[model samples]
Structures are given as structure tokens and as C-alpha cells.
Target chain A: MKVRWRVLGGEWQETDTEAKTVGELMASLGLSAEEYLPSIGGKLVTEDEELKEGTEVTFIPVVSGG
Target chain B: MVSCSVCGKPAIYSAKYEGKAYCGEHFLEWFDRRVRKTIRKYRMFGSKEHIVVAVSGGKDSLAALHYVKKLSKRVPGWTVEALLIDEGIRGYRDVTVKDFKRCAEEWGVPYRIVSFKEEIGATLDDIVKKGAEAGLPYQPCTYCGVFRRYLLNKAAREMGATVLVTGHNLDDEVQTFMMNIMRHDVERLARLGPVTGISGQEGFVRRVKIFYEVPEKEVVVYSVLNGFFPEFVECPYARLGFRWDLRHYINLLEEKYPGTKYMILKSLLDIAEAVRKGKGGTPKRCTVCGEPSTKDVCRACELKALLGIG
Candidate 1:
């Protein structure tokens, strides 16, 4: 499957990976659930949510302050 | 393909708390409308009031400033300006100050900066060093928070602003509520709301959190989509604070059960309302700075005396 991951204020890249779940994909990228909020196709997806081909995922940091 | 919950278009953000997906156009619309709703619901400011937006060069404040600036254009007689406080963190704050000034210039908002060194005769670095040497019981954030609030309010009032708008989003509010609960600080919790500070109080300007209902992730996405996303930098001192631990724990809960942040905030509001009704006391002026205070000496004044700063 091809997953496009965009990190806010950072970079966007496409990768072809065999990961089947959102959690697996995040683990492959060395990302943690505690730090980043992940959404697939504009809807927040859980770690167990199955990833489909050509899904666009965005990662946003969970912490912000003024 | 998922569609926007409001309109039939490619959705760009899924607001889990609201259980709604929004396309770029609709998302911005939804976000702005919700902000307006918060303002109206809280009666934060009048249409003709001057608003001082506290910008930290972070995503949250920048977005708040941008949105308020945009809203000011439509609201007749409204004026918006930006204020930045330089806490004097050597490596961290200097960079964010530059980002803040650049954005303020780009947005054409009149801006002013106040610093700890100029206002208090000591930089935060000096305070931390002296605090460590003096063996102060509190962390650096304790001093920073008290002084920042003091400076922000003073500067806003000096600018003749009736309302001081901050970028505290839902995540920050919830974490603070939880922290207060854990510490059993009822007075501090009572003061938490979308808007705070009593009107007609001397030396007190109303402070409103425009993004109180909005989540942190949504603020980032809004900042990113609107071309306001600056590089993210966490305060070096923040890592050592209890709030940091609370933030991580809250985020974990939010991930497992979406809308947990909002639920916490809702409960806090209810409790805060009850506390406010039960408590009736006027704010006293700080003896040192003449600012509104709950105690004989304000927190800022207390910290300054501890640091031996003028």
C-alpha cells in the first residue's frame, strides 16, 4: 500500500509499505501515539484502524501552548 | 473517499470531538464560526473594543492573532494588535521572537514587545540562576508563569486594550483543570473559563481564550492550512514541569477516547460556575505593582522579591 504522510510545519512524503494497520505504519516510522495525532482521509483513525491503499495520513503534534 | 460533513467536498480535517469531517473551505468556515460562537457565548468583547492578542510565535497564538485580525476586518469599530513577551530564554525565546515579529509585520498588525529584563531588571536566565543559587522551592515555570501573566496584563492595559486574547486551546485548559484538581486549588480552578477577570476591576483587563473549545491538533492544522505554521519549539523549562506529565497523560487518554479533553473542560466549567457563585470576594491591589491580586502580595511581586529583582 502507498501511504502519504504529512507532518504539520514539517514535510510530506510518500512511502510504499506492507503495514496493514495505522499503528503498524506509525511504528514503522518510529512515531509514538502519545506525541502525535494521526488522521487518515481527514478522519482521526485509531491504532487498530486498518489502512487501505493510497490513504493519505496526516500527523499533528498533540501538544500546543501560547 | 470521505466527504465533508457539511458539504460534498474532499474533507481535510476530521474533528473527532464534533464527529464531523470538513473540507478545506468548510473547515475554515466551521472553525471561524465556532470562534465567533465562543466570543458571543462568553461575551468576551464588544464590537468596538480594542483587542490585544498575545502572540508567542507558536501555532496557537499565531492562529488566534490571525483569526482575530480577520474577524476585526468584518466587525465594525474593532481594532486588533499583537503583543509579544520576551521571557529571555537564551536560545529558545530569541528564535520565536523573530518569528513573531516577522508574522506580525507580514499581517500588518501593530505590535509591541515587552521583556523580563526591561520590565523587571532581570532576565529569566538571571532569575533561574539566582533561583537555583537561592534554593527556591518552586520550578522555573512557577516564576515564568506568574511574571508572564503580570507582564501580559500590564502591557495590554498600557496599550489601552479592553480585552487580552490568549491562544489557550482545549488541551491546555483541560490539563490545567486537571492539574488544579490534583493540587486541590479551588480558587485557581474557579478562575478558569473562556473569559476571566471581573469587569470594572481596577488594573485588570479581561482575558479571553479564543480557542478554549478548539483542540490543539485543530489549531495546528488551521495554522498549517492558512500558511501560518512556524517551526514548533518547546520551551526548555517546560520539560521539567508537572504540566508536562499531565499533558502526556491527557493526550494518551484523548487518543484512546476521543472527546475526553472536551468532556473534562465541560465538567470544569460546571464546577467553576458553582465555585464562582459560592465565592464572593473583591480583588485587592498588589502593594508592589498595584495590580489586581487575590492575596496581599501578587504572585509576580512575590517572585520578584524572592529573586531580588526590582
Candidate 2:
């Protein structure tokens, strides 16, 4: 299935992959290991969870804390 | 003919450092080394983490951000993120908005912009309005200092930034130091230093001033030689007139005495230590925001209420 992934400040891109898990989608996106699990719409979605066709993810970089 | 005093070579002796003479090569080398040493001595950004730069879209911030990007890439263990706060200065914010947006794109650091109007109830202009209502010609910079800090701190915490770096340099510090001297604000001087961390605040990030020790001229040279400023206009409300006078006064003192910044910092450190030693009470939690504060409300909250915010 084709899933849509959009990056903030960048245009959305679609990818074709056979992988059903969020972890697999992330692997396809070229995310490095150091990147933390991001909270999508306020909940942290882990690698094992399955991603749907139209799910949106927000990657909050872990920097800038007071 | 005697050797020049500045770079110690044969050149026409001129009046910069008391009729000093030096070759062009020595002069450039001396200036370069001074910039490097000051950068290192102040420990501007720690080598281990990605640096989050706070730019106001002004010359000082733009220069600082650009230089840090160049220097960090050359030195390992250095990464950068650029953050800008649009204080909504009439034409100024709009003028620099596009450039600031493009700056991070040019440098390739994931950038975030938080507007003053969006995050807080008022832009800097609004703060001055409320402040002016009290019949005080209080500095816009003072309100800007407070608002900018709160915005940055909240944004930093939200992003989990390790180091919050600013563009404050020697001249600003020297001017502030002179202000402290005029007011005899020994405690304030002490609390102000290269790196500052408010006490008893668990989530408070450490603030570092990389250019804290560098002279104002070096920063100006770094900017002019490089010629890129996202925006260049004094704040519309910089009507205090005193701060500008203070700046000139410090420059005059610096002409007669170099290293005045170091002297002021030295005095500040002494007072900071004294304040740390039994000078402050256990800071109570602010009733409003629950952040650590000795008083019922934090300065941010107080100012927020002044604007009729919750």
C-alpha cells in the first residue's frame, strides 16, 4: 500500500512499500537510529505499531529544553 | 625607524593603541587570535551537543548564527538548530521574516519560528504600551529581554534543547556592566556571567554566551566582511536614548582601557558567588505557573497579567 508521509517545512512525499509496521515505514524514510520515537498527534507511536494508509506523524527533534 | 608596536613590523605608526606600529599581517593575526581565544574562554557552545541558536533577525544574531554554522561544521561534535522569534516590529519583522526563513534552509538546520503574538498575548509593542501606561519610559529592551527569554525558554523546553546559545558579545556586556556600576547593582552583576543557570529549576536549560568575551569590533568586522543581515533596523521603540548613550560611553572607556569587559565580568562573578552563599532563600514555587519562584508569581506571569492574560 502507498502511505503518505509529510515533513514540516517540506512537501509531502508518498512511498510504495510492502512493510505494514510503522518501524518499516520509518526505515524506508531514511531515519537514523538516533532519531527518537516521535509523538504523532500527541501520542508516541512506537516502531512495532502498524501504520495506516493516511496516518500523519510529527517528528519533534529532542533539542532546546529549558 | 623603530618596529611598529601593534604587529611589531615597519609601518606608519598611527593612533589606535597609543601610536602603535604593526605590519598588516600581524594586525590580522592578532585580531584572529583574539577572536578565537575569547570564543574558547567563554565556552560559547559545548562541543558535545547540537547548538540551538536564537536569532532576533538582527545583525548581531545573524552574524552569530552564520559564524557558528561555519565554525561548528569544521569542529566535530557540533550541530546546529536555528530558532527565531518574530516580535512583530512594524516593518522590521516582515522585512526579515523571509530572510530568516531562508537562513536555516541555506544552513540546513531544522528551523522553528514562534511569533510573539501567537505564543504570548502581546507583541513587544504591546508590552511597552502597558509599561508606558504606568508613566515610565522604561526601555523596550527590558520588556524585550523578558518576553524573548520566556518565549525561548518555553520553546527550548518543548524541543528538549541541551544548550541555549545567544549572540551577546563584549560590548553589550561592557555596557551592562557600566549600567550596574552606575546603579551599584552588585548582585545583578554577580548573577550575570558567561554561563547562567537559574537555581532550583529542574527543567531550566543552561544558557551560554559564546561571544560573551569577544569585543564588539570583531563581531562588526565579522558581519561587515561577510555582509549578510536578515534585517537591519533599530527597534521602533528604542526611545530610551539612554541605552544608546550608555553604549557610546562604554566604547569611550574601552578606547582608554581594553579588557574592561573582563573587569566587569570579574566583579559580577564575585557578587554572584556571594549571592549564592546564603544570600538567597529557598525559592518557593510560583502559584501561577508552578515554576520555581520565590514570589507568588514569576516575572513572566506578572508581565502576562499586566497585559490582562491568565
Candidate 3:
């Protein structure tokens, strides 16, 4: 399956992976589910949320400093 | 699809810490109730009060403002206002400030914006450049943090606010706790809790963290659900601080060890309570700015002198 991922402020890029869930995709990309919220198809979803082919996941960072 | 733990509707969020899932409606109810519970537990507000919400156009701060505004509508004598400190970070603060204005107006909450350039005689960008040129041992965050806190207290006090509210969640609290412990700054640790500062301090406004017990991820979820999530803009200088590194590492631990953040917060509150029961530190007035401080000169004044700004 292919999943498109991007940080909130960055550009989206595509990656082909066999990751089945949000948690798996996060692990595959070296991202921590604790630090970022994955918005799949414009809605925030849980880690167990299933991914479909070419699902766009925007990782919104939860922790930030000013 | 996961079902809502309560109503059988489709669930939008799974509260891992509580082992429950919530639909949009139940989640808001749970979150708002939890926030109110924290307020009640801390005795955060009076019957008639003016709250100055420290907003930065981020999810946490905006959600703090939104929730406070919603609560105030039920109390006739209570008023909520937004206060923003413009640090003059070109790309970052600029974008967030626009969102701040939009939300404040949309919610019908009056707001005040205080700029570092106007108040401190230099913008944050200017201070950073000058500090670098002068070989000052400070990061951009150091200057930004001191000035922002000083200005928020000063502005809130001037606005006759009974209390100042911030959007600091559990993740922030734990990270600061670990940072303070690492630096052996126990005095600062004593000052950390849902409520901060000595009540009725002459120059300091009482500060409360409404989301102190809430996790950062929940804050994001709340903001998104409430439609208060602003454009996600990362501060340009954010990664330069030790805090940025600490935040990432702590989050990693939280991901691996599910309840690590809450455990850390529990320990922090325990230490803070024990220290508070022992004795409170005497507050000193900054001879330069006359703000409450530990030393005769406050950190803000010290930074101003280092940056060669008035």
C-alpha cells in the first residue's frame, strides 16, 4: 500500500509501505504518535485507524515552543 | 470503525490513558467536564472574576481561550479576554497573531496585543541578532520566554484580571519538571502546579493552567473538534532551545511507556505540594522594572541589559 505523509507545515510526499495502521506508519517513519496527531483525510484519527491505499496523512505536531 | 464508549456512535478519539473511546459529542463533554473538575479542584476562580487568557494562536492557547469564553457565558459576573504577546518572530508570530485576532473576534472576546518592540524597545528578532553580535550566552527562546512571561503578567495585572490562564498541558508540565530536576532548580519546581504564583502578589497576576491535567494530544483533538485549531506554523527558533529536544525525548518515552507522562506529572505535583507545605519563598521586587522576582533585578531586565535595549 502507498501512504502520503507530511508534517503540518511541510510538503506532502508519497511512500510505499506495507504499514497497516496509523501506529505502524508512525513507526515506519520514525515518528512518535505521542508527539504528533495524524489527520487522515482531513480528520483526526486514532492509532488503530486503518490505512487505505494512497491515504493522505498529515502529521500535526502536538508539542511546540515559542 | 471504533464505536463511542458511551453512545454507540462512531468514535473520534480513543483516550488511551482512560481505556475509553469517545464520539465527538461525548468527547467534548468529557473534556469540558474534566477541565471544570480541574478548576474546581484548584479553586481557580472567584464568583466575580476577569480572566485574561494568554493566547498565541496555537491549538492549546486558543482552545484555552475558547473553553474559558464558553464557561464565562454561564456566569453573569465573569468576563474573559485574550492577551497575546507579539515576540516579533517574523514568519511564526505573524501568522499566529492573525489567527488570534480572528478567533478572539469570532468568540466576541476583547483582546490586547503587547509587542516586545513597543514594550521592551526591541523586537525578538532584534534582540536575538544583537545578543548574538554581543556574544551573549542566551538562545532566542531564553529572551523570548523571559520577556513573554514578564509582559503577560504586567498586562494581565494592568487589565485588572483576577487571573491569567495559559494552555500548558500535562506534557509541558512533565517536560519542565524533568528539565528543572536536571538543572537542579527545585525552587522553580515548587512554583509548578495547576495554580502558580502567590495569591495577591502585588505585581504578579495569579496564573492558572486549565489544561494542566490534560495531555497535549487531547488538546489537539479538542481544538480540532471545537474548530479552533489554527494554521499549524512551527516557530522558526523553536528547535534551538533545550526544551525542543527534551519535548521529543519525553514524547518518545510516552509512546513506548503509555502512561509515562502522567506518572511524571504525578511526581511533579507531589514534589511541588511538599515544597509548598514546607515554606514559600519571599518575593523580591525587581529594582529596575518593579516586577516580582527572586533577585533585585528580574531575568527580563537582566536580558534587556545584555541585549543593550531599554
Best by TM-score: 3
Query: Could you tell me how far off, in angstroms, the CA of residue B229 lies in candidate 3 after the best superposition?
Result: 1.1
Question: What docking tier does model 1 reach?
Answer: acceptable
Better of 1 and 3 by TM-score: 3
**Global CA lDDT of candidate 1, please?**
0.83
DockQ of each: 0.30, 0.01, 0.64
Colliding residue pairs in candidate 3? none
Off by over 4 Å in 1: A1-17, A21-24, A27-58
Rate residue A20 of model 1 by lDDT.
Answer: 87
User: Candidate 2 on B58-114: residue-level lDDT in tens?
Assistant: 656766788778778777987778788887677667766676666667777677788
TM-score of each: 0.89, 0.69, 0.95
Q: Candidate 1 i-RMS (Å)?
A: 4.8
Highest lDDT model number: 3
Candidate 1 lDDT by residue in tens digits, B184-284 = 88888888899876557888989999999988877876886787677667788888889988888887787679888888998999999999887635689
The segments of candidate 3 whose C-alpha lies over 4 angstroms from its true place after superposition are: B277-279
- TM-score, B chain alone, candidates in order: 0.96, 0.81, 0.97
Looking at candidate 3, what is the lDDT of residue B190? Answer: 89
